[model samples]
Target chain A: MGSVDRKDILAPQPTAVSESVSPALEIVGLSHSYGSRTALSDVSFTVSPGDFTVLLGLNGAGKSTLYALITRLYAHRSGTIRVFGAAIDRDPATALARMGIVFQQPTLDLDLSVEQNLRYHAALHGLPRAVTEARIVEELARVEMSDRRRDKTRQLSGGQRRRVEIARALMHRPRLLLLDEPTVGLDVAGRQFLLQHVRKLCRDQGLAVLWATHLIDEVGDDARVIVLHKGKILADGSVPEINAAQGTPSIRAAFDRLVQHGEPSQ
Target chain B: MTSETVEIGSVPATGPIRLTAAHYLRCLEGVVRREWLRFLSQRGRFFSALVRPLVWLGIFAAGFRFTLGVSIIPPYETYVPYEVYVVPGLAAMVQMFNAMQSALSMVWDREMGSMRVLLTSPLPRWYLLTAKLLASVVVSVLQVYAFLAIALFWDVEAPWWGYLTVLPALILAGMMLGACGLLLSSTIRQLENFAGVMNFVIFPMFFASSALYPLWRVKESNLWLWYICELNPFTHAVELIRFALYGEVSWSAALVVVGFLIVFMVLAVIGYDPARGLVARRGGSE
Candidate 1:
């Protein structure tokens, strides 16, 4: 795995509007359920501009459920969801417009060429014809899949398909990117490659990011972490804050203590 | 016991559901383009749709010719051949297959995780479904017209102007079947259960309609059964085409076909609404 520098990964860049105060995404009291099953109950958090926010949880801890609500896959039964100060339900188009999402499953059509898939996404965001021609080329180049653009998705390896999916999601240049376990099916090298590229994009472009996964090792000590368990926000703070609370210096130990015993490390 | 007022997943109370037609159309167009490409890649799909009709017309109709004699119907002026009588029905049959196959694909879409991508769009669910219906209708119409051209070349002919009127008839029939497809797509949760549903829907719709023989031919058996054929929406769709090909109009058939289209479309929209959770797959770990 490639080591990404914290400074380079969290670089603060220019903002046309003042960025001293408001965060990129703000969620408050967002709760939802499936039938009698409470999937997410009163979860709340905030992600600042250029902040690499990683959500840590166990299976059935509501990471995917929260992802569903945030991306508007499954609407929230209650609570406030705001992306760049705009409410998701009030102005869903504008809220969704500001965000790029890579779903847990690969949504690319196996029958269509990689270029065709990118073109389809570009059109969905209402990109101009003149700009689309340039954007498609630039995007594929960024993911290092330019040569394979002409090939159908079924022909590509799993890692290649994942890379193409990332490239396609970035075509709109969204202010925030939501990655729901984007690296699940990738190997060690492939995962590290995607993570490095994503970290660079966030630092260079000042794009806010929410990376949800059940594994604690996926995130670094400096990144903001939220612990979700049994549809509740168990903890929300920087990694050191959680470590301090758990009486341990490492995040993995703190996470293990919180998830296994539901208490701070003694 | 009081009915439980259980509130499941819903939109945050602050934002209203606002989705414009134009934005919805764009997303729908992208999905339809992908689906069309998938359909084109499959070779076996052609055998059931394009070749199946020809087989029935050439072999079945020719064999039945010597056994059963068909009388002239409203659109026919004299003792017309049985093949000609079945052509309009065959055209309607193409539309039926188109609608159900699209529904079957929707079930497959759920299995493959593609449907969730489309549902996640910011547009309202109703508009998303309308776009899907329109795409299926367009594909169905193209296939129907292709069949018409081939039948005409074989001397199963109608008035030259009949082609123009047939356009509206095809659209009406397409919407009727397309709406039904959307309903089934919403109701069906698993892909394995689709084959049984397809057999149930397609056979009843085709055999009950005037597509195979004249409605009068069945009237001789039982007036009640004849009423069922008369009231069948597929029959009206067929009659709509039959009259259109003869350069005539059947106002009653037009009304019935249009009426069902609205009802089926409404059910499709409601069934897919997130609040209801009818089409929502059960939650699971990835």
Candidate 2:
């Protein structure tokens, strides 16, 4: 992370995201549990096209649980989750087809080269063999990882690997991108680079993003946030709205007040 | 809105949405290719998978030759050495170990591996799981062939044509064992304790079946153990492979193997299903 080259970690290059005509993700009353322990309860939210929505939460705050439900890794029994108007369980093929996800854990096969990993993803999406190579080249170039395409994932540094993962997530041309704690282990520059790249996706390409993170600083001034604490949403609104509700100067202050006092900010 | 994104979010169909056959085919190829590539890179497994069986052939066969006395079994035309009697069992052993290895890897993938990438695919869950099963089966079949070729050098011979004919039997056996592994994997909550459970399952299945000894001999000793051997699916799998390797078909064993494949596969699918599966009951992919 310390030796990360600036050239290798390029700033977000503007690219056209596939346009989304409606809200990308809609969850209503989604709740999940593990035996006696509830992970999420009656969670509801929406991310419109081109919006960078932050799912803010602390550890065990149900952010990952929310992600698991949306991604269909775990079933949500109590609520309806619609992605681009398709319910997750009823029409999973359509619901998941338009979505791209970067899980909190590193999912790349370290033994495979960067290109192989990207190619695997394209194949999973059933992307045409002809366009797969071209798409891989395009996405790799966005992360400044074109030169490292032939290198095995284990050979790359942590930041470089994260860049490749982000590239892989977008290979399907998904309109909705969900990244769960994408900046967990990266350096300051790496984190900033990831933030800028994803934010730019929302700005330049009309891509809807749900960025889940515990880091308060990741919530920017223009960000729409859904603050989740202890399996419940404490605030679901723009940064200013949350701050105003809590009579605070910033979202950080608002979140602190909400978590400490156990009061809803909205 | 771009055509690509809008096309996916179209009004939901009432029934299972159909995708092009080519799409499923390509996904299958990609997954199989990845699984094979990963299996080969871990060189230690070659030693563990092949050598253990070879040791059984080289050592156990020598010691058991006169005492255990393999009489003319249906698969063999005349009296034979323990090595020849054990080849099919060892080949099935390779497949069984391969199956367990698949289960172990799936456990790892569940928590922090490429499984996240896999489950996220728009393809149906059953299709994805079946493709993964096929991948492991392909690897296990190749391992059986490799072991057979080596067995030839050791003078533990089967008819050359048996080499070609045994493939289908090995595949059926592989799937049965693989699905069983998948079912076991779905039940396992964590990775660290899997090997212990695997040893418990594998050793019991191997010893309590016809893999290393004839069920009749066990019948001679204890009728109840023979009944248990007859009931073990691994017995059916190994017997199916044994008869096939001798260019014969054991329809009963084959049917039993197929039956177990279906049962295990259904249980595994149920175990992995997000809506009603064990995964959601336990803590999900953490």
Candidate 3:
């Protein structure tokens, strides 16, 4: 954040080994069904490094389903999810090692202290105890919950819990971060903070990010967007590209046109 | 949540990709630590686990003390008190209950989707599940030993060295029961559903086994019922503990318990497989 320029990271650097040419997340011919009801039908997309991509979808639009497949929470039944070129199913250890996720639900253990929850995650990643303690302090400080680390998660407010969750996601320094409706229940300021915080990670660290939300306003003017409706991709491009495809000037209009007609204009 | 602009430390530029034996060991240690903390927090579970077995040993055994007499069993050198006869059964009961209790928690986690946190780990799923089982076994063993210690005051005791010998038997039994719980948990979807399953599993497993009386007693009463008792894995677990407590080994019981453990553990691994097993069908949500 100090003296780091967004424009500097926006461009590719030859020296960055972390910035592999491969997409951070690549899903091809991904189809998942819950019995007869098809949740996602042939869904596919790619989130590149340093890209702030928003998965825009309404309720039951299969945004969560796509997240499930990518995160390996639910298996990829028909297609493939590759993280940093590592297929999740074939080599999940390698694939998952490169990605971090914040599930929509509050997955934190309410009974444990905030610090304990984070430590547990670190341990799962195989971090040493010495490193785990330091990382816990550092991440808690980032979420501004360092003081509340000792308190049980149940004692935290909704926004506080969300912040802790975000902190937990960063413990292992994942190259790609996936957040599903991360700001669903937060206030305006809280939501704004989360969106901006993640955006900065993209701009500053060259991290790939996929932010799934139904709120169109969260779709920034310069961000890439994937509009999912009824488990199919209606649009996948930058704000201007999506807007131009629908002959709309703004993201809201383009998203409205895409959702209202239930068809991809392009 | 703090509204202030909080600065996370600079990203590592590259995330670590290498893992070693230390990582797996750390994970195991962490799981054990979490399980121990949770066990400590749930004092009621520990209390109930002990009280339920003690009731059978104290009231149930005492009531049948004069009415029912246990003859000289191979594990027993001579006629032991009814209280003594029921000790191993009660210990096995503790482990079985612990297994189901741990299973209940797993089902809760899975239903709530919090289990995804553990499942998403870079570690092998089977290893993670085994770590969970072993952790539960540690807690179950603690309860079993505690029950044995308290039974001493009730004038029900094994040889002084029997307590030491029973450790492995207890662990093996705990693992066997825990594996069964894991296999069951993968099929279950709701917390409420677990209650019915628990009753179906725990009661029948306890009563249909040699928990209360010897298989010989059941054989004298009803031949078919005795066959069921003989086939019960809980019976083997109890016998294993009984023999181990007496500084001996029940080879047939040991083999059966070991065989079931392998079968259950393998099925559990399969049941949780996202692609091939019921895991795909269980949580059909996207």
Scored by DockQ, the top model is 3
Off by over 4 Å in 3: A1-20, A263-266, B1-18
Candidate 1, B-chain TM:
0.87
**Candidate 2 chain A — worst ten consecutive residues by lDDT sum?**
A1-10
Question: Model 3, residue A111: what's the lDDT?
Answer: 77
* TM-score of chain A, model number 3: 0.90
Q: Mind sharing the TM-score for model 2? A: 0.92
**Recovered share of real interface contacts in candidate 1:** 0.24
lDDT by residue (B1-286, candidate 2, tens digit) is 2233322222221223346677788889888988888877887887788898899888888788778887787978888778888888989989999999999989988867468799899989998899999999999998888899889877977788888889999999999999999998888888998868757899999999998889889999999999999999999999999999989999999999999999999999999898778876788533
State residue B170's C-alpha deviation in candidate 2, in Å. Answer: 0.6
lDDT to native, each model: 0.77, 0.84, 0.84
Pairs that collide, model 1: A76-B10, A77-B10, A90-B15
For residues A1-266, could you state the per-residue lDDT of candidate 2 as single tens digits?
01211221112112223533335688889888888888888988777667788999998898988998899988888998988777898988877777899989899999899988988887777777767788889999998899999999999988899999999998878878999999989999999999999888777776778999999999998788889998999888888778888999989889998999864445
* Candidate 1 lDDT over residue span A67-130, tens digit each: 7777766667689898876777766766776678888888888888998888777656555455
* Candidate 2 docking quality: incorrect, acceptable, medium or high: acceptable
What TM-score does candidate 1 get on C-alpha atoms?
A: 0.88
Q: List ranges where model 1 is wrong by over 4 Å.
A: A1-22, A263-266, B1-32, B280-286
